[model samples]
Target chain A: MAQLVLSNVYKRYDDGPKGLFRKRKVHDYAVNNLSFTCEDGEFIGILGPSGCGKSTTLRMIAGLEEITEGDMYIGDIRINELPPKDRNIGLAFEDYALYPPLSVYENLAFNMRAKKIPEDKIQEAVSYVAPLLKVDDLLDMKPPALSGGQKQRVNIARAIVRRPGLLLLDEPLSHLDGKMRQTLRQEIKRMHHEIKCTTIIVTHDQMEAMSLADRIVIMKDGVLQQMGTPLEVYDDPANEFVAGFIGEPPMNLLPATIVGAGDGFEFAFEGSPLRVAVPEKYNPVVENNMQVTLGVRPVDVLIQPGTEGSGAVPVAVYENLGDERRISVRIGDTLLNTTTAEDVSYHHGQIVRLSFHAERTHLFDPKTGNRIRSNVEWR
Target chain B: MAKIELDGVTKRYGKNTALDNVSLTVEDNEFLVLFGPAGAGKTTLLKTIAGVEFPQKGLVKIGGEIVNHVEPMHRNVSMVFENYALYPHMSVYDNIASPMRSKLYKKDEAYIRETVERVTKMMKIDHLWERKPSQLSNGQRQRVAIGRCLVREPNVFLMDEPLAHLDAKLRHFMRSELKEMQSSFNTTTIYVTHDYMEAMSLADRIAVLNHGKIEQLGTSQEMYYTPCNEFVATLFGEPEINLFPAEVVAENGRLYLSALGQEGLPLEEDVCQALVHREDRSYDVGIRGNDVRFSFEHRPGWMAGTVYANEPIGNKVIMTVDVEGTHIRLVAPNDTRAGLDQPVYLSLNMKNAILFDSVDKSYVIRSDAQRFTQTAAAAGR
Candidate 1:
């Protein structure tokens, strides 16, 4: 097992020419000054949107891409100057590039054979890893004859067959269907537990990162935003982008102006009749007449059938989504979504009372988009 | 808006059957979603409605008129392809207005500008109007394609996974936006996607297809609560539905379902009554992850199991438990934690359990019917 550490790593790329007359002069930072550490045998997920430099960071760690600055260490050894072959890292990418001509057993033993490992040892390694990935039956079959899930399993088996100190997987489940993806995700988790190898997976899917990783590193536009466990990131996001990007149906971000009301602060939406009292804990971070954005997840918003209360908004759309009921209310130009139980019933155009859980509500600085975290601990 | 209908539609390409004996109806101004996995004939059905593909057998009707032999241009339907087929040379403005400039729907420049402006604004692509397709992102180009389709006052709209290529956050935003757009336009729509969530959230009715056959057609709730078969039951829901082969044993005037060497999972009285007439002993128990409950302490009627793995997925934790030899997944609160190989007790929410015939994969007992009748009998009592 290897504990990986990256200290202020940076990857820069030079832009190509835009026109015949001019050459681009500036260098683009695909990965800015980013740093994180993965403990030994720990599964870490680097998650972000496309072009967010997650893949770049993973490539740098794998020695596939050169880092322009800073040092990378694997358990006290500097590996920035080392080649990929010397890093002892097993790699599995989105494409399961298995050799079609070779059988599954041959594919698993190919890497060992190149390193001049004895015949019996290669055979023993393939046999041991095949059953672990549930590809024992597929040993004689080639990649072309196997299903997508089976092929991916074989690919992963080949990666672990070498027993490398570190394993790097990039969007390993992106190509599979929903059901197949879930099944493979469990298989990967099981394999990790059995092998106890340090692993780093880069993916854009929040659910995948949340479910698989021991810790998650969320990046955006080449900059590191937050690093925490799935629950920590989901429950208390560092910024508006992390808050909005982490959850399904997303967090509702409504631009509101803070105003003094009854010895406390209330956030009043612009050009709408919706207003919510700011939680008392946020009073220290917020000021009267200050511009702030109020953030609340869809699950945190409570909805009633009628507009009988002080904070009631008209429902624009109500959908029964089998597992849950989603209600959308238009406050100002922004559509705020609230998710309720599947059994909850509401009609379109019906007025509904809306209330945000004070403890769950988030206040953000409109200028920097950072969360206003006071001393109060979130439940 | 027009009501669309397909009667006994079957399309074949050489030896391959793309669509087999499919029939459906879309009411006027209603949004119908054709949902299935890849190669399930969702796109073919959408094309048949758009008059882009001709069916070998069956009638296609638009607005109560038979349009089986109608040309694509005369069908009065606009389609948005999975790949946004925007003209690279044309600006976003021109691309959106191209449908209006067609000979079939020729309009004055002022009217075209007004329509384009309205649609572009609605799609939030007005700022990118002057830029060509090459300059826009995938999401922006998709909006332009949708805007192009929306600019026309068509009889029906056919969208083939328009949001499939978008990122997760954008797709969620676009799903609700598309629903709102459908309502405001009041246009009949035939949307196709493999995403069950999209089908559930966007459709007034969903037609689930598999191997070119309609597996089930109903509201999202109906299909979810009363799935016709194991295939339909497993099609929706995350973690998929847990399906394990079991044997239905009747003893002592009570019913029990046993599987994987574990026995005596007692069924409710209502469920027993429903399964009494079934002669088949072999069955498949279908339970959603959320419907299965797990605890550290042993409870009566609960089966002992070992935790295979516990995955925390933000809001919920999905625990894969080994009950005997069968793997059963159960959902719990995110705060719930369990160690690997830890002994735990598992119980099913009897009200939510479903049963399927093992031989033919058909539903033997549907929980929705049991719940409905139970409520009715309670009201009567």
Candidate 2:
């Protein structure tokens, strides 16, 4: 195992012959001045939506794409100029890319054999990784005979068979369905624990990143937005984009303005008769009549009766999603979702007091889309 | 609006059977979802109803009329495929207006403009009126396709995984949007999806298909609470349901479930009654992840196990424990953490478990079947 370091990394592509005169050339930076370190045996996830340069960052690390600028090092050795095969990085992509006619065992051994490793050593490596991925029994079967989940397992097993210093997974579970995806996700976590290689995965699925990675790097529009543990990003999002992008139902981001209500100020939702008292800790950063965005997750919104003096919004949508009940209340043109596990059923148009947890509530700059920092810290 | 009925429909191509002897009725204005895995013939069932594919063995009826020989263009049914089948050359406005311009449903330019704008605004794509399909994102394109379908006055709307291509956040947002729009649909609908969450949230009643057969058809509550068999139960929940073989032991006029080397786990009165009439002693106990309780501390009557895996999803943590040889997964709070191979204790809520005949994997009994029926009845409304 080895620590990986990237310093001031930038990947830019030439946007050529596109100007009105067709003479000006411009460069579009897919990855903009990114720097991060993965400690030995650490698992990091590069998470973002499409065109966010997450895949570009991963490919640069794997040496598949050349670094447009900056330095990359694996342990104490700089690897920016090294070829892909010499980088000792394992890759498992969404496509299995396994040899169709080759058996699982043969597929695992194919790379090792191509490298001219001893026959006995090749067998030993294949034997160790096959059981870790739970593909021991399927080793004898050809790739065409395996199921999607089984093929993914073998695909990952083949990547780890060589005991590379770093493992890179690119949307490894996207092609799978729900049940199979969950099953394979757990297996990947367990496999990471067993192997403990410095691993980085690129995925658009927040749940996959939250579950598998020790730390997550959130990106957007070819820039790093935030880097933290899953809980850190979830509970204390640094911006409106991070807040809305992290959760399942997503955080409710409503445009509001700060207004004075006696001693303490309150946030008045735009175009709606809804107001929530601002937490005391945020008073230093916020002012009355200042436009802001109020952010709160569905789980942080509480619905109680007989508290209409507080913000009371009529339920516009109520859905029973088996394990949880999702209640959405209309605020102007958009709806704010509130999720609960209580057995109570709510009807549409029913007036209910919706209170935000003071500690869990978030305020953002409406213009900049950045979090308004305060002294509040989640315990 | 019309009611659709498929009676003993069986479709085959050479040696492969896409749909078996299937019979279903989608009431007028009711939303019915067809849910299963990839090859479970959910798409085949939807295609059969839209008159795209004809079944050789049975009849497809729309508004009490047999449509076995009907051409798809004349059926007055709008279909949204998994892939957004949008016109690449046309702009978003023209693509949505294409349906209204068809000969069967042609309308004047004034009405077409009004209807196109209304559906586009509702679908949150009103600003993309001038962009071609190639310029839109996958999510945007899918919404445009659905908007085109929504602009028509079809007797039935058939959608196959409309939200499958969207990202997690957008998919979640659109699931709510679809549920909100369903009430105003006022048309019979048959939706197909491989995602359980989409099916559970959108369907008034879900039909679980497996290997060209309908395993069960009921409300989401019924499907979740009292699934007909083990396969159906596994399909509805995350972490999959924990199914382990257990033997019914009778002692001192009381029954117990012995599983995973843990003995003397008392069975409830209702379960005992159901088990007394069954001829088989062996059964597969099915328990959902949330029904199992766990702790790092060893409490009374809790079985000991080793931590197999701990995954922290957004709101909750799914912790797996290896008890003896079986791995049981449970839902823990988000803050819970445990090291690998750490000692843990678990106790099953047997009252909430469903038992199946071990040999055939068919439903034997559940202690609280009455509660499922009540909730399902309420949900159906």
Candidate 3:
């Protein structure tokens, strides 16, 4: 396995012309000035929503799309003009692009056969990777007879049969149902453990990226948003978008104002009586009456049941989601949600105390949508 | 406003059966969700209730009156299909207003304008009022379709995968929005979706269907804690529950259940007595990921295993451990870090586990069966 690198990679699409004058060439950059490095044997995930340049970045790395301007490298060798076939990379996409008429074994062996490998070596390679993905028992069956999950397994098996230096997957689990998707996700993780090839996965699902990747590269509108470990992004988001995008149910971003409460400052919500003391780490970073957005995940919001005078808010809605409970309280027009593992039940109008964890709370600039880092250096 | 009931309903197309002997009752103004996989007859059941598809062998009743032969238009039920099915030529304003302007439910222009604006704003599609269906995004079109349905005072609302087209984040946001508005519905609703999260979050009651049959119909608590069968148990939780065959052994005076090559897994007194009285010596044990506890360091009464995989989802981590020959999965903290083939120890929380009869693959008992049996039995399960 070898490390992969991209320096100032850019992909521009010339839409060409507009408004009765076809003279000007309108250049649309799908990926702009993207640069990152994947160390040897490391697993990296490219994460973003649809049309956010994630797929375009993956295609550029695979040599499927031409780079408008940049340098690409695998280890120390530059590979900008290299053909897709010449690059030692394996690809598996959302669709199971298997040969319908070919048996599972033949479909896996087809790639090696085209490379002019000997028959015995081809059999050896196919046998080694087949059981890794649990497709060994279906070797004789054609692609038409397999289920969607089974077909995807075979597709992954075929990609890894040749054991290329790098493995690339694009939304590989998007087609399966929930249970089947979980099973395949675990299998893919196991396969990665067994074969430590440098891997890159492109997906819009944050769960998939967080579970599988050692580090994640987030993008938005052809611009790189942030790149870090899953926990790093979760614990301290670089911006409001990353904070909102990285979690399930997303994070609650409410507009608030910094007001003086004795010696310190408190975040006061608009049209509501809720006031939270600003965390001590941000003391030197803020001023009184500053407009900002307060970010807190549902899991960090704690609910306390009590009588009046203890700061209670009526529950707007309570959802029993099997293993956990999701409670929502309205703050003016916005509904702030909190997730808890407690088995307590609350009705629509029940009053409860809501509090946020001081250490886990975040602040973002409302105008720029950027995070406001603390003045104190924290790990 | 209305109660929905189906008695032994069966619908067939040629040799294929879409719904078979299905019986269900949805209380007045209740939000009942029909949840299952593809081709599980969820949509078919909804259609039968909407009078779009007639049952060949049974009766359909609304508000205790038999409506088996009623026409779709006369049923007074608003239905939203998987596809938007909006008027391509009209703007969003007119599409939402058309429902109020129908001959059977016609209203004055002033009332129509007021109701249309109110519904569109609630659906967050007010800005797209002048945009045609073709110019809207998939999410926008779906909102318009739902807005049209919400504008009328129908007895029942039938929605089929209304949030299926939106992306994950938008779907999540809209689900909460839908649930918040459900309290104001004050109308009987039958919603169909294959997503378990939505089914658990929104449904006052969930009907689990498989192969054109209702497997179980109950509250989310009953479906999670007291599932009727192994199939229903596997449908609720993420990472899925771990099911393995376990053998019961009675030593001296105490009984212990053994599996995964480890013997003497001490059971609680109630659980031990429940299994000892049974005639079967072998049964299936299902442990959810959260019920299985693991430690990197060996602890007393814990079984030794090898770390097979560690997947850290955003909120939590699902760690798979290899105990003997069987792979056991458990939930871990998000910051959990482990290397491949590392030694790990696991201990299952038997109190919360569900036991299934090995012969029929049906739930026998759980140690904490009383937690849900009271409510489930009261619901006439």
Best by DockQ: 3
Candidate 2 yields a Cα-based lDDT of: 0.88
Cα deviation at A121, candidate 1, in Å, is 2.6
lDDT of 2 at A372: 89
Tell me which of candidates 2 and 3 scores higher on lDDT: 2
lDDT of 1 by residue, A98-121 (tens): 999999999999999888999999
lDDT of each: 0.85, 0.88, 0.87
Interface RMSD of 1: 1.6
Interface RMSD of each: 1.6, 1.5, 1.5
For B181-287, candidate 1 gives per-residue lDDT tens digits of 55556688888998888898888778999988999887777677778999998888877789999888878889887875668877877778878886788888888
Model 3 DockQ (Cα-based): 0.60
Which runs in model 1 stand beyond 4 Å of their true positions? A14-27, A376-379, B82-101, B107-152, B260-264, B368-381
- Give per-residue CA lDDT, model 2, range A160-184, as digits (tens): 9999999999999999977789889
For candidate 1 chain A, the 10 contiguous residues with the lowest summed lDDT are A18-27
Best by TM-score: 3
**Model 2 chain B: which ten-residue window has the lowest total lDDT?**
B177-186
Listed per candidate, the RMSD to the true structure in angstroms reads 4.5, 4.0, 3.8
Q: Native-vs-model 1 lDDT?
A: 0.85
